[model samples]
Target: MVGSIKSGKSTLTNALFGGDYLKRGAGVVTSIITRIQPGHGLRARLEFKTWDEINADINQALILFSSTPPEDGGGDFDINDEKDRLRLQHDLSRLNTDQLVSDDTLDPNCVLLTEYLSGYDRVKGLVSSEPVTHMFESDDFHKQKDFVGDESLAVYLRDVCLTLEAPRGFGENLEVADCQGSDSTNPLHLVTIQDYLIQTHLIIYVVSSRTGVRRADIRFLNLIKKMGLTKNILFVINCDFSEHETLADLKGLVGRVEKEVGMIFPAPCVFTFSALYNLFKSIDYKGGVEQAIARKDRRRLEQWREENDMVAFSDQQTEKFLKAVIQKVSMDRFALLLVSNLERISSISSGLRDWIRINQDLLKKDAGEVQEAFSKMGKRQEASDQITMVIKDTLDGTTLKLRRNLGNDVERFFDSKSGEIVQDLTRFIRSYNLSIKDYEKDLDASGFLPTLYRIFQTMQQTANLFIAESINPKLVNFVRQEEKKAGDVFEQVAGPYSLMIKDAVKQYQRTMKKLGIKIQDRPFKAVRSPDVDSVKSDARLNIPRLAGTIQYSTRIKTEAILRLSIYKTVKTVKKLLKKPVKEGPDSAMRSLEASVRGIKKQMQESIKDHFLDYKESLKYQYVFKLVDAMSIELYEALTDRMRAFTGNLSDMKGRIENEGLAKDRLAEELASMQTSLNVALKETRALEKLVMIDE
Candidate 1:
C-alpha cells in the first residue's frame, strides 16, 4: 500500500485485515514498510540495516546536498574539517536522527543501529496487542523515520522493515504491505516501493477521498503501472471519517480519480472504503466474538468517535456505515482474492504433473540413443572435458578474486607509504639551520655523523614498513581467505555432475520411486590444507642508500650561511663559516639545494625498484606454489565425484532394467494431486461468493 502521509494507509490496511494489527497514532506518521502475514503466534521481528548500509545512505544524502554548487559560489561544506562538519550533523539531528547523531558514536553514520524483537507471545495475550504493536514506534524504527521532514509526521524514512500477523480470519494466505506516502519528496523511497511492488500479489493505494487525485497520486499510479502491477491494484478512495454525504459525491470523487489514473486502475478496481469507521467497527464487531472488549479499547473507541465527529452516530447510522463497507469493500475481498490465486497455483501444479510425465517418456528415448553413442566413444574423455570446464570457471573465479584483493593491498601500502615518506622528508629538510653562519653552534658539530646516520635509519625503517610489514600480513590473510573459497570450488564442482546424471537417468525409470532408485548424496572431499605459509614473508631486499653528502662546499637553502661538507677526495669534513669575496652566498645555497634534491630523487627511485623486484619474486615463491598444490587437490576431488556419479547412474539403470517399472504408483499419485486441485477450486468459488464483488 502506498499513499501520502496521514492518508490513512495503516488504518486502511487494518480495516482490510478487519482488526488493528498496526499501531496508528494521530496525524501524519513515520514511513515504514510493514509486511503482514498469518502467524501461529503474535510476534514482531524488526531488522534495521547494518551500520555500513546506514553509512552509505548518509553518504548519499550528504553527497546530494554537497554536489550542488553554492549559489554565490563561495564553496561547498568541507566535511573533513571537524567544526565545519557540525552543520550537517545538526541538520540530521534536527530531523530527529537521535541515535544516529549521538556524541557516543565516534562516527554517527558508521555506527550500527541497534536491533531488537519483541519476545514472541506464544500465548495469545490479554488485551496487549495494542502495546505490542506500539513497540515498533521506538528507537531505530522511530528516529530513522523523522529524517524525511514532516515534523508532525515523518521527517524521513530509511532502513526499517516491519512484519505483523493478524488472526486467522483476517490473514491466512493473505499478505498486505504499507509504505511511506506517495507525496514523499525523497526519490529513494520510490525506488524501494518499485522493488517491493514486483513481490506483492496486489497493491492497495489509499488516497483521501477528499482530494480525489493529485499530481503525486498520478506519478505514483504511473509508477505502479510501469512496474507491471496494474492488473493487481485497487485504488481506494478512503473516506475514513468524512461527514456523511450523498452517493453522487462518492461517485463524483470516483469519477475524477478514474479520469486521472483510470488508465491504470479501471472503474471496476476503484474502491471507496472507510478506514476510520471500519477500524473502530472491526474492534466493535470483535468485542462480542472475542471474550469482550477491554476497558482500554472501549475508552479508545469513545475518543475516536468524538475526534471524528462520530459521537452522534446511533445504531441505525452505524449499521448503515457498515452495510456501505460491505457493499464497497466487503472487508474479506482481498483475502478471498488471495485464496483464488492459491487455487490457481494448485491447478498449475496439476498441469505440471502431466508435463513431467510426458517429458519423462521423451527423455528416456533420447537418453538411450545418447548412451549408445557415448558407450561407443567411451565416457572417460567426456568426464575429463566436463571437469576441465568446471575447473576454469570455479577455480579461476576464486583466484581472480584473490588477485584483486592482493592488488588493493599493494596499492594501499604504496599510498600510505608515500604519505609517511613526505612527512619524514619534510621533517629532515626543515631541521637544517638555513641561516646559521657557524656550524659549531647550530649544525650539531659534535655528533654530525650520528645525526646523518639517524636520518638514513628513519628513511630505511619507513621504506621497510611499506614494502615488508604491510604486504606480509595482507598476503597471509588473502591466502587463507582464498584457500577457503577454493574449498568451496571443489564443493561447487560436485553439483552439476549429479544434476546431469539425474536428468539422464530419469529417462529409463519414469517411476523411479517404485524401482527404489535413490540418487546417492555425497560430498566432495574438501581441498586439504594447501601450503600458504610460504606466502607470508617480507618481500623487501637490498635497502637503498643516500649516504654521501654534497660534492661542493655549500649551504642547503637559498638564504643559508651554515654548511658542513664531506670532501669526496680526502674523506674529511670541513665546516664553512664565511664565503670568499669572489664566491656569492646565494650561489652556495643554490648549489647545495640542487645536490639535496638529486639525493632525494635517487633514493625514491631506488626504493621503487627494490619493491618492484620483490613483488616479482613473490609470484615464483608464493602464488605459483600455492596455486599448483590447490589445483592438484581440487582436480582429484572433481574426478572422484564424477566417478561416483557414473557408478550411481549404472546401478540405477541396472535396477530399472532388471525389475519392472511400476505404472500403478504413478496413477495413484496423479489421482491424489487431482483431488487436492479439485478441493481448492471448490473453496475458491465459495470464497468468491462470500465477498460481494462490486465489479
Candidate 2:
C-alpha cells in the first residue's frame, strides 16, 4: 500500500491480515516491501540487497538525513541539538572520508559481516530505555562477519522475508504487501516503489485525514497511475494518529482526496479506517497479542502499549470509531471488493474455457468433410482452406466476445462502486460532534519543594521513552505475519483453478459421450507454492545508539546553576535562622522553587533533542527492504494462474487439431458448441450478467 510516513500502511497490512505483524513507529517501518503469502510452515526467507543496492539506499538515506534544508523545516534548532553534527561525523568516520580526501583506497575488507544477534540479546537483556548499537558491515562488499539467529533475531532484522501461519482466515492467493511512505526522504526507495507497482494488483493508498493530499502524495499517486496500477490502487484515509473524527469529518477528508487524485483517477471516496482504533475493535489488536503470547514475542507489544497509553487511547477511539468505520469507510466493503476481484477472474477464465471448447467441437465435426474432400487431389487444398477459414473466423469472434464481456464487466464494476461512494461521501464525512468551552475558573495548585537541589534532580530525570521501544515488536510481529500471509496466498490461488477447471471438464466430457466414444479426462497440474527458508546475510551493521547517548548538552552549565542555587538557598535559610529578615521563610522558599521551575522547560527540550537525533534514522531504514523484496514475490504469485491458463489454452487447441476422433455426431442438438447454451456456459454468463446487472 502507498502512504506517507505514519499514515498506517504497516498497521493496515496488519489489520487486513488480522494481526500486527509489521512494525509501526513514529518513523518509517516499510523500507522494504513486505509480500505476504501462504507458506507450508512458519519460516522467513529474507534476502539482503546486494552491497551496491544497500549502498545506494544508505547513500540516499544519509543525504536526506544529513542536510537541514528548508524542506526539512530548517531553523536554528536548540543549542542542545548536536545530532546533526554528530550524525554527520559518524557518517564521515564510517566512510573513511580522510582517506577519500587523501586519494587513497579504503580497506576492501570494510564490507565484512558482523554478528548482531548476541549484541541485540545483550541490549535486550539490559531492558533499559537506553539506545544501543548493532553494527552493520555496510561499507564494503568483500568483508564478511557471519551472524545467524543464535538466541535472538531483533538486530538481524532490517529488510526481511517471513513466512508464518496463525490468522484464521489466511488464503493461498491473498497477498498483502506493506510499503513505505510515498514521500519517503529516500529517492532510491521511491524508484524501488515504481518497480513494485508494475506487478501490484491491489494497493491500499493510505493518507492522513489531517494532512489531506499534499504535492508528494499527488506525485507518488500519479506515478502509480502511469505504471497502470490505477484500478488496483485503493485510497484509505487513516485518522488513527489524529483526534477522533466523526463521519462528517471523514466525508470532508474524502472530498479533499478525491479532488487531488481526481486529476488522474476520480476516486469518489477513499476507505477511512483507523489502524490504531482497529487495534481495539479488530483482531489486529486481539489476535496479534494472542499470537505474540504463543510465540513468546508478547513482552514488547504488551509493554509498549501500556507505556504509550495505547489501551486507554484505543478504548477512547473504539467508542467513536465503530460508528465511523461502519457508517463511512467500512472494511467490510473493501473485503467485498476483494471477493469481487476473485470472482471476476474466475468468470473471465470460465468464458475463455467455453470459447476454447466451442472451437474444438466445431473442428471435430468438420473432420469428415475434410476426409471426403481429400479423396479428390485437386479439392484437398480448397477443402482444408475452407475448414481453416471457418475455424479462424470462429476464433476471432470468440476473442472479441470475451474481450467485450470482460471490458464491460470490469468497467461497470468500477462505475457502480464509484457512484455508490460518491453518493455516500458527504454522508460518510458528515458534520456531527459536540463543542466545549474552556473551564471558567483557574485553581492555583501548590506542591511541596524539598530543596533547590532535589527539585532540579527531579526535573532532570530522563524522559525514559526508549529509542528502541515499539520497534522490535513491530519487526517481530510483521515478519511472522508475512510468513502467515504467504501461506494464505499460495494455497488460495493454487487450489481453486484446478478444482474449477476439472469440474467443468468433467461436465463437458460426460455430455459428449453421445458421440459413441467417451471423452477422456485430462490431468491438470497445479502450480506448487514456492519453498521459503531463512537466509542470513554475512553482512551486519552495528545498530546506532540514540537513547543511551542522551545527556544534557549543557550539563556543566546546568550543574553549575544548580550548585549556585543551592548555595543561595542555604545562605537564605541561614539568614532566616540567624536574624529575622523583612522576607519570611515562605518568601525565600518561593524564590528557590521558581528557579527550579524555570529549568524544567530547558531540561525537557534537551531530552527531546537527544532522542530525536539517532532515532530519526529509523524514519526510513529497514522499511523498504521488505517492500522491495515482496513486491517481486507477489508479482510472481499474482501472474501464475494467468500464465498457466494461457498454456492450458494452447495445449487444448493443439490437442483438438491433432487428434482423430470417432463419436456419434449427437444431433445438431448440441447446437454448434460455439452457440451452445451448455450448463456451464449458461452459469458463467449468468454470473457475468449478475455483476453487470448490479451496476
Candidate 3:
C-alpha cells in the first residue's frame, strides 16, 4: 500500500516482486483498483468493476439510492447532482459512525439507507454549485481531478476480496495494489487508504521527481500523519532518466522531494529509479529488432540500408541503464531485509528482563543496609549525654576560677571601677556581637559550609568572653587597668578576652579530637637536621687568641677616710579651725555605711555587665554541644553505611559485568546464526539460478 498520486507506488511494487502489475502512464493512469496477487504460473490478474457496480456501491454507502425524484420529474436525476448529494452525505456521516446501521438486505428502506438519506439532501445542496460529477467521470480524473471517490471504493473492494483467498506460494501470497494517484482531495480516498496502510504490514510510498512534492503530496502526508502511518511508508522516487539525463541530477531532485515528503512520512526505506527505463528493459529487444532487420535486409540494397538503420536505432544501450535501475529497485528489497533483521533483534527480551531482576535485588540490599545503619546510629544517644556533661564541667571550672580569684572583694572593686569597666565591656560585647552578626550575614550571602564554621567559631569566642567577664570582677578590673594603661578599654578587654577564647577553643578542639573527630590545626615543622656540608676540615691555634699580652699603667693614691656633712631645716605652723573635728564612733559607723552602700551599687553593676557579656557565649556553648553530639553520631553512621554501600556496589558491578558478558555472547550467537541462515539462502538462490540457466 502507498499514498498520493505520482508517489511511485506502482514502480516500487513492480521492482520488488518483478513484473509490471500496475498501469504506468502519464499522470493517474490507474483509474480503478489493480490488485497483483500470486497466480499458478508467472502471470498477473487485473480485476475491474463495472461503472454500474461502482456507482451502486457509492450510492449505497452514501444512502443516496433511497432518494427518488417525483414521477413527473422522471427517474433521471442529474449524475452531477446525485454525486454531490452523495459526497455531502458521506461527509456528514463520516463525522459520526454511530448513525450507521447494519443491514443484510441492500434495499432503500434498510437501516443503513435511512442514515445516509438523512444527510444526503444537506450535503447535495452544499456542493451543488461545483462540477464534481463531470470531474469524477472524466478520463483525466486519475491525472488531474485531484480526488477519486470511486477509485477509493475500488481499492477497498480489492483488499476485502483478496483476503478471502487461501495462502499460496511465496511469490503468489504477496499482493501489490495500484491505487489512484489523484485521490488526494477525496476524503473517502484518504479514509480507505489510511485504513489500508494501518492494516498492511508493508507499504511503499511512490513519488515522481519530475513533479517533485506537490500540493497533493502535502495532502497525502497530512492524511498519513492523521493516520499515524509513518512506520509503514517506504519512499520510492520514480526518476525517469528520459526526462532527466544525469543520475546525480535525478538523485538531487529526488532528494529534495524525499526531504519535503519525508517530514511527514519519514519512511525507513528510500529508493530512486527511472520507471520508464524499467518498462523498456523488460522487453525482448534483441530478438524483436533482429527479426525485423533480417526480413528488411532480404529486399533491395537501399532497403537493407534502411533495415540496418532500423536495427541501429533499436540498439538503445539499455543493459547499463537496466543495471542502475535494478540497483535502485533493490533498495526496497533491502528495506525488507532490514525490517527482518530488526524483527529478529526484537525477539531477544531476556537481557532487559535479567537487568530488571538484578536491579530489584540491588535495591533490596541497599534498603537493608540503610536500615542497619539507622539502627546503629540510634544507639549513639549516650554520646550526646557525655558531651553535655563535658560542656557543663568546663563551664563549672571557669565559674570556680571566678569565685576563687574575686569572691567577696569583687563588690568593693566594682564600686570603684564599675562605671568605667561596664562601659568598656559593653562596647567590647557590642563589637563582638556586630562581628558575629556580620559573619552570620556573610554565611547567609555565601551559603558555604566553611563560612558557616567560621561564623560558629567567632560566635563561640564572643560567647566565652561574655561568660568569663560576667563572673570575675578581678579579671574585669585587671582588664580595666590594662585598658587605662593602653588608653583604649575595649582593646584591653578584647585582648584578655581573646586569650580566654583561644584557651576555650583549644579545649573544645581537644574534646572533639578525643571523640575521634580531629579538627584542622596550624602546621608545625619538625627540628631541622644538621647540615653536614657546613662542617670544616681544618682548625687554627694562636697564642694571641688566648689573650697572651696587654700593656698597662697604674697610679696609686692613698687617701684617708673623709667625713660627710648633713644639714636639716624644720618649720612649724599652728592653725585654728572654725568647726571642730569630732572623733566619735557614730561618725566612723556612718562613713562605713556609705562605703557599704557604694560597694553594693558597684557589685550590682558588675553582675549586670558580666551577665550581658556571657549571654551569647553561653547560648553558643549550649548549641555547640547539641550539634557536636548529633554530628558525631551522623558521621559514624554515614561512614559505616558508605563502607557497606561501596562493598555492595563492588559486588553488583562484578555481577553486572559477568551478566553483560553472557548477554553479549548470546547476542553474538544469534547474529551468527542469522548470518549463516542468510548465507544458506543465498547459496540456494544461486543454485536455482544455475539450474534455470542449464534448462
Candidate 4:
C-alpha cells in the first residue's frame, strides 16, 4: 500500500494493523523509510541523523572550539572570523577517539579544552586521510558526519532495508511489512513500491475514507497499470470512527470514489474499518476500565492544560492501532492461499503429460507406415540393373523375332504404343498440374501461401527424381510390372497422398479459424448507371446543323449592330471635319485626312480590348474544369488507399493474436512431451532394475 504525505495513509496503515508503528508530525517527521515487523520484543535501532540535529551539533562544536584557550597556557585563540571557526570545528568533529575526564564539575577552563579537543578528534577521524581544511568543503564529509548521531533516522532506514532484504518472517513461513507513509511520494518510495509490485504475489492498497484517493494515489495507480500488474490487489479503506451515525454517508462517499477510480481498483475485494475504535477497545482490555473518558472534540487546547496526559493518550492510540493492523494482514495472507489457482496449474500440467504419452504411440505407428511405403519403391542400383537387362534382351532376341514375324509393321506398332504411352503421360502431367494449381488456390484462400510455397520447394527434389530415371531400362520394367500388379502406382499412391493433403488443408483451416481470420476475395465493382437515352438521342441528332443555325443568327445581329454604329460615327466625324477646315483649301484637306486617321485608330483600339477580355474568360473556364476533374480523382484514390490500409491493419491484428496463442500452445505441448518422455524413460529404467534383481 502506498500514498502521498498527510493523506491519512499512515492512519489507514495503523488501522489495518490495529496499532501505530509510524511517527506522525506536522511537516515531514518520517524523513526516511521505516519498516515494522511482528516479533516478541519491542526494540528500535538508529542508523542516521536529521538535518536539524546536524546543524545544532556543528554549531555547538564550533562554540566550544572558539571559546577555549590555546594548549601552551597562553591567551585565547583569535577566532573572530565565523567562516574560519566553522571550518576548524568541522575538521575537529570528524575525528574518532575517546577522552577520559574527571567529572562534569571540572574547572571551566579544563571543560572547555576537553570538549574542544574531543570534537576535533571526532572530526579528524571522519576526514582522517585528507588535509584538515579539506573536510570543510567536501560534500561527502559533511553528509557522513552530519547524520552520525541521530538515532531515529538511522533506525528507520536500517529497518526498511532489513525488511526488504530478509522480510518479516525469514525464519518462519509468513511476513507482513508495515511501511511508513511520510515519504510516500519520494522517488525511493516509488522504487520500493515498484519492486514489490513486480516481485510480491499480493498487495493490499490501504486508503483513508476521510482523505479519499489523492493525486499521488492516482499516479501510483497509473504506475501499476504501466507495469501491467493486473491481479492480487486488495483495497483496505480505513475509516477511524467509533460511532455509526455517519456510516451511510461514508459508504456513499466510498461508492463515489470507487466509481471514479474503478479502472485502477480492479481487485476482487475492498474492506473498510475504524482503527480508533479498535484502539479504544484495546485500552479497555489492557487498563481494565469500565468507564470511558468522554471529552468534547476541539481543534486545539490551552498549552498549560495537560501535556503528559496528551502524550499517554497518543501512545495508547498508537499501540492499539498497530495490533489490529497486524491481525488483519495475517488473515489476508492466509486467505490468498485459499483463493488463488496457482496449485491447479501443476495438476493440469500432469494431465497434459498423460495425453501426450498416449498420442506418441500413434505417431510412431504413422512413421513406420511412411518408412515401409518408401522401401517398396526399390533402391537406385537394383532398378538400374533390371532396366539394362530388359533393354539388351529386347534388342537382341525380341527385335529379331518381331522383324521376322511382321517386318516393318513391328516398327509401326512400337511407335504407336510409344505414342499412346506419351499421351497417357501428358494427361497425367496435366492432371497433376491442375491439382497443384488447385492446391495453390487453397493455400491463398487460407492465407498460408508462403508456407505452401516452402512445402512445394521441399517436394520439388523428390518429383525431379521421377523425370531423371523415367527412360532407364530397369525403371521402365519396374514401372510396367507395378502398373500390371497395381493397375498404376500413381492411382495407388495418390489415395493416401490425397488423404494427407486433405488433413493438412483441414489443419490450416482450423488454425486460421482459431485465430479468428476470415479470408475471401472481395472484388470492387462500379455502381454508376449510364444515361442510355441521352446518349442515343445525342448520337441521332446532328449537332453541327443546330450550331450552324445559332451561329448564323448571332452573326447577322452582330453585323447589323456593327454596321449601324460605325456608319453613324463615320457620318458624325465627316460633318465635324467639314466644319473644322476654315483657314484655307490646303488646311481643309489636312483637317479631313487627320480626322479620318483618328477615327480609324479609335476603331482598332476598341476591337483589340474586346478580343483580350474574351481570351481571358475562356482561359479561366478551362482551368476551373481541369482542377475539378483532378480533385475528384485524388479524393477517390485517397479513399481507396485508406480502406486498404485499414483492412491490412485489421488482418495484422488477427495475425498477432494467432501468433501469441500459437506460442502458448507450443510451450504447453513441449512441456507435456518432455514430461511424457521422462516418464517413459523412468519406466524403462525401472524394468531394467527389476530384471537385474531377478537375475
Which has the greatest lDDT?
1
Q: What lDDT tens digits, residue by residue, belong to model 1 across residues 441-547?
A: 21233233222222332333344333222332343344445445544544555456445444433432333333333332223222233322211211211112111
Q: What is the C-alpha lDDT of each candidate?
A: 0.43, 0.41, 0.36, 0.35
Indicate the worst ten consecutive residues by lDDT in candidate 1.
Answer: 112-121
Q: Which runs in model 4 stand beyond 4 Å of their true positions?
A: 12-21, 25-31, 45-156, 160-172, 180-185, 240-245, 288-695
* Tens-place lDDT digits, model 4, residues 350-431: 3334334323322233444423322331232233334334433433343244224332322222232343323333333333
10 residues in a row with least lDDT, candidate 3: 556-565
Model 2 per-residue lDDT tens digits across residues 1-695: 77887677777666554554555542332235656665555444444333233233233223112222224434322212356434444433444232222114221111111122123333333223333223222232111112222212322334444443534433444455666567754343464455455444456678887788888788777566544456545567776433533445556666777787788787433555556445434553454323434323344344435434434543454444334334323333334443334344554454455444544454555666433322232232243334334434543453344334433432332232342221232222222111111101100111122133223332332122111222222322333344345444444544553454444444444434433322333344443333222110111212232223234433333343455567567778889789654554343344543454444444445444543442333222322232223333333433433332322233333344465532333323334544543555566556546445231
Worst lDDT 10-window in candidate 2: 434-443
In Å, residue 88's CA in model 2 sits off its true spot by: 12
Residue 302 lDDT (model 3):
38
CA lDDT for candidate 3: 0.36
Per-candidate clashes, comma-separated? 9, 65, 12, 36
> Against the hidden true structure, what lDDT does model 4 obtain?
0.35
Deviation (Å) of 199 in candidate 3: 1.5
Q: Over 4 Å off in model 3, which ranges?
A: 15-17, 26-32, 42-55, 58-69, 73-172, 265-268, 285-695
Error of 4 at 9 (Å): 4.1
